[model samples]
Target: MRMMDRRTKIWILVLVVFCALCAGAFLILRGIGGDGTVAVISVDGEELDRIDLSRVKESYDIEIDTGYGRNVVHVEPGAISVTEADCPDKICVAMGRLQGSGIPIICMPHHLIIAIEGDGIDG
Candidate 1:
């Protein structure tokens, strides 16, 4: 077996430290965008509404009618969803409520996207 020289050991240490820092940064940034507190609604890539889910007290529905089609968004404390939509596929309604920073609810037929975003984060 061959022993590593002092310079080789130092280089290896530097590489380990660099990798550790990169991993730490990646974890911190991932958590920063997790468990979002707001919901953003958009159509055709244009923002239509931003709702603070944390402050919501009562559940309600929003009617969105655009050139593409129509959607009914249900909003409640800490969550939002598309309860009804006129799109042919109805995939947005099937997506269910927005939870955390997972996949967003999208209505491709209507060009609508409902996404959850963390504080100060835009979707």
Candidate 2:
């Protein structure tokens, strides 16, 4: 066993504090996501459709058929997700639903993308 010197202890404390601060900043930024009500669907860098999830009263399914493949996007109130995908991996379908502006659902084989964006934050 070895005892840490005073300088090593101070440096360790500094590192711990810095890490704590970084974690705090990350949490704050993550919590302050965009207004997350409008979902934008795109295929191969081309905009296809935009749906306001906030105004959705009943859930609906949107089928996106590209030349590459197909994906079924399920839309619910305040959220959207890919319920089915023809891609081999089917990762998009496994992503469930997007709650905020964290990540976009993507189907690489189909070149389909569904991203949530902020319309405006209401006070």
Candidate 3:
């Protein structure tokens, strides 16, 4: 009976440790980025397009028509920036270059979002 009780206690401890590790991993990954395909770009919560890694351009510019105004998206080598926005405060442009896969560039006034995502196996 004593041996059985010790084994059970050990198992419980092991299970608790495993759960903690899993939780830690979850939080860490969430902070850095998502595990799978996140979002590349979305407008008004409606995804307009995705950035194709294979077809990634060294430099490109995007113009968004927010109905209320216009937002220009610019991406250069190693960095991306927003040049112009019709918003009262140019917070999105001030965000500077964005390279994280989880976090996205959000223009609340325009309801536009841009993010980095992993290429699907099929992609």
Candidate 4:
């Protein structure tokens, strides 16, 4: 077996420390923007509704009919999604459920934006 030189061992230790710090930062940032419990629904830059998913006990649907188009929002327990839409691409409906506080569900044709907002994690 060959022993690593002093410089090589120091470099390896520095690399390990750097990786640990990076992982810590990532975890902290992820926790800061954890899975949100509040969902905000908007259309054409107008704030329409805000639902707290944590308090939801039953599943329901909200129909949004704007001048641009129409969309059906489904809310259940701790999740929200666009189940139906009249847009040309139908991308919003295909976005599935809102997961955490990351990318929001957007419908460009209808000018709709559904986003989850909060710093607290969903239990």
TM-score, cand. 4: 0.69
Q: Model 4 segments beyond 4 Å from truth?
A: 1-32, 120-123
Per-residue CA lDDT of candidate 4, range 29-70, in tens?
666766777898888768899999999999999999877999
lDDT of 2 by residue, 1-123 (tens): 699999999999999999999999877755565757788898987889999888999999988898899889889988999998889999999878887765678888898888877544221
Assess each prediction's global lDDT (C-alpha) against the native. Answer: 0.86, 0.82, 0.68, 0.85
Pairs of residues clashing in candidate 2: none
Residue-wise C-alpha lDDT for candidate 3, range 37-79, written one tens digit per residue? 3335677666666655334558889887867668888866445
Worst 10 residues of 1 by lDDT: 114-123
Question: Which residues of candidate 3, in runs, are more than 4 Å off?
Answer: 1-39, 118-123
**TM-score-best of 3 and 4:** 4
Q: Quantify how close model 2 is to the true structure by its C-alpha RMSD in Å.
A: 4.7
Candidate 2: regions farther than 4 A off: 1-33, 119-123
**Shift in Å, residue 19, candidate 4:** 20
Question: Residue 73 CA error for candidate 4 (Å)?
Answer: 0.4
Report the Cα lDDT for candidate 3: 0.68
Once model 4 is optimally superposed onto the true structure by TM-score, how far is the C-alpha of residue 58 displaced, in angstroms? 0.7
Q: List the lowest-lDDT window of 10 residues for candidate 3.
A: 30-39
